[model samples]
Target: MTLPTSYRAYKSNADGYQNLQLTQVDLREPKPLEAVVRVHAVSLQFRDLLVAKGDYGLPTGAGIVPCSDMAGTIVALGEDARRFFSVGERVCANFAPDFLAGEPTPENRAALGGERDGVLAEYVVVPAYSLVRVPEHLSFVEGATLPCAALTAWNALTGSTPIKGGDTVLVLGTGGVSIFALQFAAASGATVILTSSSDAKLALGRKLGAHYTINYKTTPEWDEEVKKITNGRGVDHVVEVGGLGTIERSVNAVRLAGSVHLIGTVSKGASGIPLIPAILRSIKLNGVVVGSVRQFEDMNRFIEARGLRPVVDRTFPFERAREAYKYQDAQGFVGKVVIEVVEE
Candidate 1:
């Protein structure tokens, strides 16, 4: 089949603020081991804001596409692509190309949207080995939320110290990863505890099966509340998104030998962990990046079997991509923020 000569993509310039601009660019046919995907939807992460503001620690060069998560249908394939994907299957691109299965190494840590070009486009050409079929029950918008946020949450729960049934989980906030963790853990028969500034979001978390909810703003010593909820034993796992600011509290909120999955830095100040308490409790702090293509496939299978739908806060059209970035920055949503590339 013939491909379009050019397609539209949101490109980020090196200006320190919101410098996203839509541009038409030439589309090239895939190489022998590649597949060209017609991207149907894309989603935002907190890191996209960093990349847009030139603060993402990596060298985000000019003309870089800015989002790592996308879902699409295969429009064209290379000579050997048929071995893995067909011409019309729905799929999502892996966030990292080299980190396919095992423990991450420095050599394989190049992630999309920063070290590499991302998927905020009408089409993307990816290696055939890097695409995972979307869950059978998910819409393209829902599938678009999986690559980074959902996968990171999956790795946090099942990667290092896998949570078992009846284990109690403490999720930090109602952001993308935290919400996904809540859903996945609840489905696994674990009781979930979540914290958020919004009582309404906490109510929604309860609706999503979280057993207990805390308003961190009101209850500053929320860790003590966690201990009380668990009868002074603390929780089995803590999804720690607050980085240094909240790590101390997270360390205090876990049971002996429990795990803490470190995923984000939503907090800026207080970037130091209280080492003594962590040592006393024997809390395992695991750093989480998005997982591999194999893990993505496993996650898709679980999501399909359970009929789990990713919660999307809101969606913007492809032309309104800049507004989507600003919306993500305001952080007013519950789950993922999406951009619908195909407006059907």
Candidate 2:
């Protein structure tokens, strides 16, 4: 295989995440077990924002492409990679690179966009085992958002959550993961109670099948509202993104034997958990770190068969990748933010 220098959008330095430029990069010839992707689109996650700030502790150089979620068509294959993912197939690169079909391993845990290079570049070489076929009906923009937020949502929801149809779920905020969880829970026939700081966002959550919405900014004691919404029974599960500021309240909002999917925090560090409430309720708290390849495939199948659409708050041209991160930071969009790499 011949190596060609490809143009990629990269931040000049870790602190320059908001400032990026296109530069020519030579892609290494794929190993027999690798696939090289011609990236079509990438999505912005909080981790990408952190990478710009030098927070993710990833391997980086000046002008690194910073992102985790990407969807693209395969263009190159290693000598022995043909049996895995075929060239020309649309797929999303997996975060858990080495996890095959079931349980995770230490190596599978390294993940792209972290210890190794990630999907921010226009062309990325990934272990062929890590590719999950994107749903045929999903747009590139929507599919790009799934590798991170959607998979994390699916992992957190299915990890230990016992909620079934008729069970109520409490989702905090209207960010990417929460919104995906809200939509997915609804798809499973579970009722969802969505809370947001914005009334407009709350209305939009309702439009996405949330049975109820709470303005946590105005209604600070939203757990009480949760009780009211569930007719005093409390919710069956809470997708705990509110972190230190809201975890205890999240515990307060769940019924006995309920589960909490501890996902994210816009907070500085760990969230405060009220151990007494947790002890009394016996609420199960599970940590979610995206998902394995099998989980992603299952999610794609469900989304495609049900005609589910992953929300795209906005898109930025690949050339404007830096500006896209800045815009995503400034705007608390109801869903995912993306960048389209028009050329590979």
Candidate 3:
């Protein structure tokens, strides 16, 4: 395949996320250990929205490409890349390229869509080791949702305390991470209890294998409902994405020594959890920031072996990327919001 000399990219400026603009620039060839991918699709996450709004804490000087999760066919590969990956394989970039297997370090925390150039473009060059092969059964759109959201959910379930069969898991909300958590936990032979304000979405969760669902809007003390569903033993795991506003309840909802995987701050600031219950219950509050490249590979193997399909609520064309962000911000999505960068 002949590589284009230049390509179009979306850049977010100081003006705001809504002020994103498309610009054409020269596409550089990859280094010896790198690969150039022609992006097919990219998925939006809450962090992407934060970066676009210039509120992600990472520096976004001048402008920055604004999405981390992408799936594409590798168009070009350098000499060393041939050892691990091929020129035509479908793959996704790891969000944190530097952290491949172990505990994350400050250096490894530099992420796509923030400190580095992202894949909201025609092509993206990343380290050869940063690429994870997509499952054979998944479409590019489904593969695109795996890097951040799916992997975060994977890490949450299997990170600190691996979820066991028959254990009860609680996922908050029907967003990408929570939905993935629900699917993964259920597939692992666990009973999943998911909470969403919308009964419609909760019904969707049941279809996705959730054993029980709670309408948090109606059940303000939804944690009590969770406990009731679990026969007062509390759930064995909680995928806590609601941050401060629901952390207290998440603590109350988990069983003794159960794990609470803290994955997001969707609730902004809603006060802190009392450590006394956490201390007394010996609950594990595991903070998950996506996962390592090694974990991505592990997840892909599991996904492919099990034929797990990512739930993508809607897709938009590349030109409507800003609309995709706004739609995600509107928070009506049942799963993931993806932007199709190229046709299948």
Candidate 4:
């Protein structure tokens, strides 16, 4: 296949989403260990919004393409990269390309969409080692949602202290990560309790295997509700995505010695974690930053085995990529919002 010398991509500056511009960029040839992917679909994340607003707590260079997760077909491979991945393979790259496995280190912590250029482009060149084959059962859009949201959920459930059958999981909202956690925990035979302000989304959560649902808006002290539901023992794990706004309650919602996987700070507030209660209860606060490439591959296998389909609430055309960002920022969707780069 003939590779284009230039392709369309969205470039953002410190000015944020409203200033994002669609531009044509020169596509560089991949190095010996790299491969070029023709991006089919890209998914939006809260982190992407942060980056756009210059609030990601990292340096995003001027005019950087913004979006970490993408599913694409490998249209070209560098000389040495061909040994591992061939042209025409469907794949997705890990968010942190260098951190292949094990505990993350400072040196291996570089990530896309913030520290480097990202995948919201017609084509991208990435290291072959960072790429994983998309599951056969998943479409490009579904596969695109895995690198960040799904992996964060996977690490939360199956990380250092893996949950097992009979365990209970408390998910904070119906966002991408929380919804994936609900599905994974339920699939592993654990009971899932999902909370959302919307009763309708709660009902949808029930259909997705949440054993119980709580409308946090209706029950402000949702932690007490969780205790009541769990007979005062609390849940075995909490997928704590609400950060400062909900960490205190998350600590209260988990059982003694239970784990709280911290994945997001979507909730805005001045409140912080309850140190006294967390210390007294021996709460395990695990800060999840997505996962490694190996974990991404493992999660893909489980997704395929369980036939889990990612929930994509809506899709926007490539030309409307900025609108996709705005839609995700509105937080009205229960799941992921996607931008189709190469129409399926």
Candidate 5:
């Protein structure tokens, strides 16, 4: 297949995202190990907002694209690519391509959409090695949300501490990561306690598997509620997305030796935790920054087998891609928000 003259890309900032069109430059044809993907959909994440605003890392240089998650169909492949994927197979690129299994490497760090042009485009070429075959029954939009949020929850729950039957798991918030954590932990036979700001969304969370929920805005001391719900022993695992704002809350709600999967920041810019209390609980805090290709594959299998429906908050056309970013920023979403891209 021949490359085109140009493609579409988007950029973001704290204010929001903006779309841009560019001529396709000569793309390196798949070398022996890479695959060129025709991007079909891109998913929004909070980090994308930070990257766009120039608050995250090294400047993206000029004309850098935004977004880290994408689902697409493989259009071409390098020589050895057939071992893992085939042309036309649906695929999603891993977010932290460098942090494969245990440690991070310099090369994988230059992953798509960070210091590099991400998938907020009509077409983007990724390392053939970075692709994970999307589940046959999944759509591009659903698959797009997997590489980041879903895999992060999976790695946190399974990689560090596998949820056992009857284990009590506490999830904070109705955000994508926390929602995924609730579902994944529930599937593992753990009773789930979720915290959200809205009672309506909390109702939906219960229908999705949350055995209990707290309106954190109403009860600032929701962690105490966590203990009360767990009968004073506290939950066995806590998906701590609140960072410093709720870290102490999470620490207080976890049982002795319980594990805490530190994933996000509901309260950005500052983190305050009662260290002495946290230390006394002998709790475990594992910093989560998404997961590996192996973890992605495992997550896909679980999602497919369980018929897990990722509650999509909404879908926006490519023209409304910036609106999608703003929608994500407004935090009016209950689940993942996706942007659908089309071939020009």
Candidate 6:
């Protein structure tokens, strides 16, 4: 196949999402260990919004393409790249490309969309080693949702002291990570209690395998509701995506010595957890930053084996990528929002 000499990609400007532009640029040859992917679909995350607005707690390089998660077909491979991956393979690039496995170090924590140019493009060159094959049962759009949100959920459930049958899980919302957590925990034979302000989303969560749902808007003290649902023993794991705003309640919702996987800070309010209660209960607070490439591969295997499908709330054409960002920022969607680059 003949590779294109150039392609179009969206680049964020200093003015933020409103100023984002689709530009045509020359494509460069990949390094010996890299391959060029023709991006089929890209998915938005809360972090993508933060990066576009220059509020991600990191410096955004001028003209950086924004979006971490993408599914694409490898259209070209550099010399020696064939040992790991071949042209025409469907794959997704890991968010943190360098962190292949094990605990994350500062040196290995460089991520796409924030630390580097990301996948909101017609084509992208990435290290072959950092790419994972998409599951046979998933579409490019579904595969696009995995690199960040799905991997974080996978790490939360199957990480330190993995959840098992008879365990109970409490997920904070119906966002990408939380919904994936609910699905994963339920698939692992653990009961799930999902919280969302919208009763409609809660109903959808039930259909997605949440054993119980709480409308946090109606039940402000949803932690107590979790306790009541768990017979006052609390749950085995709390997928805490609410950060400072909900960590205290998450700590309260977990059983003694249970784990609280801290994944995001999308909510607002006073900062700080209930230190005394957390200490007394011996709750494990594990901070999740997606996962490694190895974990991504492992998660894909499980997803294929269980036939789990990602919940994509909406999809936009490549020309309407900015609108996709706005739609995700609205926070009404139950799962991921996608931008179709190649429109497979």
Writing each residue's lDDT as its tens digit, candidate 3 over 280-301 gives: 9999999999999999999999
Model 5: residues with Cα > 4 Å off, grouped in runs: 1-3, 11-26, 57-59, 105-107, 268-271
Per-model TM values vs. the true structure: 0.98, 0.93, 0.98, 0.99, 0.93, 0.98
Model 6 per-residue lDDT tens digits across residues 137-235:
999999999999999999989988788999999999999999899999999899999999999999999999999999999999999999999999999
lDDT tens digits by residue: candidate 4, 1-344: 98888998889996879899889999888899999999999999999999999888888799998999999999989999999998999999999999999999998888988888999999999999999999998999999999999999999899989989999999999999998999999999999999999999999999999999999999999999999999999999999999889998999999999999999998977888888999998999999999999999999999999999999999999999989999999999998999999888
Instruction: Please write out the lDDT profile of model 5 over residues 1-344, one tens digit for every residue.
Output: 56665666564433336534333454557788778888898888877877766677556655677778999989888888878787889899899655566655665556556677788878777777677888878788888888888888888889777888899999988878888998998888899998888999999999999888889889889988888887899998888887867787788899998898888876753657667877887888888878888778888999889888777899998888767877888997898999889522
- Candidate 3 displacement at residue 311 in angstroms: 0.6
> Every model's Cα RMSD, please?
1.1, 2.3, 1.0, 0.8, 2.3, 0.9
Tell me which residue pairs clash in candidate 2.
11-63, 12-63, 244-271, 244-272
Better of 4 and 5 by lDDT: 4
Overall lDDT per candidate, in order of appearance: 0.91, 0.83, 0.92, 0.94, 0.81, 0.93
Summing lDDT over every window of 10 consecutive residues in candidate 3, give the lowest-scoring window. 54-63
| Alpha-carbon lDDT of model 5 | 0.81
TM-score of the candidate numbered 5? 0.93
What number of clashing residue pairs does each candidate have, in the order they appear?
A: 0, 4, 0, 0, 8, 0
Q: Give per-residue CA lDDT, model 1, range 1-344, as digits (tens).
A: 78999999888875643668888989999999999999999999999888888878788778898789999999999999888889999999999976788988889888888888899999998888889999888899999999999999999999989989999999999999999999999999999999999999999999999999999999999999999999999999999988877988998899999999989998766558777878887879899989998999999888988889999999999988888888988989999999999974
Model 3 segments more than 4 A misplaced? none
Name the better of 3 and 5 by TM-score.
3
Q: Considering every candidate listed, which one attains the maximal TM-score?
A: 4
Measured on C-alpha atoms, candidate 2 has an lDDT of: 0.83
The TM-score obtained by model 1 is 0.98
Q: Clashing pairs in model 5?
A: 5-24, 6-23, 6-24, 12-52, 13-53, 34-128, 35-128, 113-118
lDDT of 2 by residue, 70-124 (tens): 9998888987889877778998988768876666666668776655666777788
Per-residue lDDT for 100 in model 5?
Answer: 60
Error of 5 at 312 (Å): 0.6
Candidate 6's C-alpha runs over 4 A off are none
